[model samples]
Target: MPIIELRTEIKASKEIVFDLSRSIDLHKISTEHTNETAIAGKTSGLIGIDESVTWRAKHFGIYQLLTSKITEFERPNLFVDEMVKGAFKGFRHEHHFEDLNGGTLMTDYFDYESPFGILGKLADKLFLLKYMTDLLAERNRIVKDFAETDKWKKIVA
Candidate 1:
C-alpha cells in the first residue's frame, strides 16, 4: 500500500474550503485526468459526512466506475471516503481542514493499493507511484488555485 499526503494553507474560510473539496463540479474542473460526475447518489452541491457518491470516469485510458461511501465527516473539519468498488484493491481518502490566522489549512490523505500482486509493486516502484502522487498533487494545486483565485471569488461573493 502506498499513501500520499498533501497539505496546503488557503486564505479562505473552513466552510469554503470544505465545500470546495467535496464539490464534484470543482473536481471535474480541477483535473483533466478525470471526467467525473455524481450519479445516483448525493447531488452536486456539497457532500457531508455519511453521504456517498458514485463517479464514472476514464483514467489512464481505462474507463472506471467507482463508488465511495463517506464513513467519517465532521463539518469544516474532516471527511473520509472509502472505496466500495473500483479498479484498485483498496482506496481511501481523507480530507481535513483547520482554521488558522483567518485562513484554512487543508490536507488530503490518499491510501490505495492496486489489485495486481508483484506487478503492482513493480509498477509502483517504476513510475506508477510517482504518477499517481503527482496527479493528486496537481489536483490539489488546482483546487488551491481555484479557491484562491478569482474563480472562487466570484462564486463565493
Candidate 2:
C-alpha cells in the first residue's frame, strides 16, 4: 500500500472548509480537468456519513468509474471515505480539518493499493504515486481557493 499525505492552510472557518470539502459539486469543479462527474448517489449535495457516490472520470486517457462510501464523519473535524469499487485493489481517504488563527488547516491522508501484485507495486513506484499525489494536490488547491474566497457560496449555497 502507498499512503500520501497533504496539508493545506486555508483562510476560512473549519465549518466552511469542511462543508466545501464534502460538496459533490465542488469536487466536480475541482476535477474539471479530468472531466470528473458524479453519475450516481448523492451527486450534488454535501455527502455525509454512510452516503455513497459513484464518479466517472477520465484518467490515464481512459474513462473509469469509482464508487466510494463515507465510512466515518465528524462535522468540521474529520471524515473517511473508502472505495467500494474502483480500479485499485482498495483505497481509503481521510480528510481532517483543524481550526487555526483565522483559518483552518486541512489534511488529506490517502492510502491505496494497486492490483496485479508485484507489477502494481512497480507502477506505484514508477509513476502512479506521483500522479495520484498531483491529483490530490490539485483538488486541495481548488478547495483552498474556494474556502479562502467568496466563490464557495456558489457551490455550497
Candidate 3:
C-alpha cells in the first residue's frame, strides 16, 4: 500500500473549505483532465456520511468506474471516504479541516493498495504514487481556489 498526505492552508473558514472539499461539482471541474464525473449515487452537492458516489473517469488512457462511500463525516471538520469498488485493491481518503490563523488547514490522508500483488508494487514504485499525488495536489489547488474566492458559491452552499 502507498499513502499520499497533503496539507493545504486555505485563507478561508473551515466551513467553507470543508464544504468545498466535498463538492461533487467542484470535483468535476478540477478533474477535467481526467474527465471525471459522478454518474450514480450522490452525483452533485456536498456528500455526507453514508452517501456513496460512482465516478467514471479516464485514467491512464482507460475509462474506469469507482464507487466510494462516505463512512465518516463531521460538519466543518472531518470526513472519510472509502472505496466500495474500483480498479485498485482498496483505498481510503480522509479529509480533515481545522481552524488556523483565522483560516483553515485542510489535510488529506489517502491510502491505497493496487491490485496484482508484485506487479502493483512495481507500479507504485514506478509511477502510480507520484501520479496519484499529482492528481490530489491539483484537486487541492482547485479547492483552494474556490475557498479563497467567491467561486465556492456556485458549488457549495
Candidate 4:
C-alpha cells in the first residue's frame, strides 16, 4: 500500500471549504479533465454522512469506475471515503478541515494499491504515485481557488 498525506491552508472559512469539498458539482468542476460523475447513492447536491458516490473517469489511459462510501463524517471537521470497487486493490481517502485564523486548514490522507504484483509496485514507484499525487494537488488547488472566490461566498451565502 502507498500512502500520501498533504496539507494546505486556504483563505476561506472552514464551513465554506468543507461544504465545497463535499459538493459533487464542485468536484466535477475541479476535475473537468476526468469528466467524473456520481453514479450511485447521492448523485447530486452536497454529500453528507453515510452517503456514497461512484466516480467514473479515465486516468493514464485506464478507464476507472470507482465507488466509494463515506465511512466517517463530521461536519466541517473530518470525513473519510473508502473504495467499494474499481481498479485499485484497496483505496481510502480521509479529509480533514480546521479553522485557522479566519481561514481553513485542509488536510488529505490517501492510501491505495494498484493491481498486479511486482509490476504494480514498479508502476507505482516509477509513475503512478507521482501522477496520483499531482492529481490530488490539482484538485486541492481548484478547491482553494473556488473557496476563496467571491462567487463562492455568494453561492454559499
Off by over 4 Å in 2: none
Global lDDT scores for all candidate models:
0.80, 0.95, 0.95, 0.86
Compared with the true structure, what per-residue lDDT tens digits does model 3 show for residues 1-157?
8989999999999999999999889999999999998999999998899999999999999999999999999998999999999999999999999999999999999999999999999999999999999999999999999999999888876
Q: In candidate 2, what are the lDDT values of residues 83-103, reduced to their tens digit?
A: 999999999999999988889
Candidate 4 residue runs with Cα over 4 Å from true position: 153-157
Instruction: Name the best candidate (by TM-score).
Output: 3
> Residue 53 deviation, candidate 1, in Å?
1.6
**TM-score comparison, 3 vs 4, better candidate:** 3
Tens digit of per-residue lDDT, candidate 4, span 50-157: 888888887877777888888899988998889888888889999999988889999999999999999999999999999889988988998899888875753355
The TM-score of candidate 4 is: 0.93
TM-score of each: 0.88, 0.98, 0.98, 0.93
Q: Across residues 1-157, which tens digit of lDDT does each residue of candidate 1 receive?
A: 9998888888878888887887766766766567666665775666666777888877778778888888998887999999988878988999999998898899889999988999998988898889888877777787678777677654344
Clash total of candidate 1:
0
- Each candidate's number of clashing pairs is 0, 0, 0, 0
lDDT score for candidate 4 against the true structure = 0.86
Candidate 3: list runs displaced more than 4 Å: none
TM-score, prediction 3: 0.98
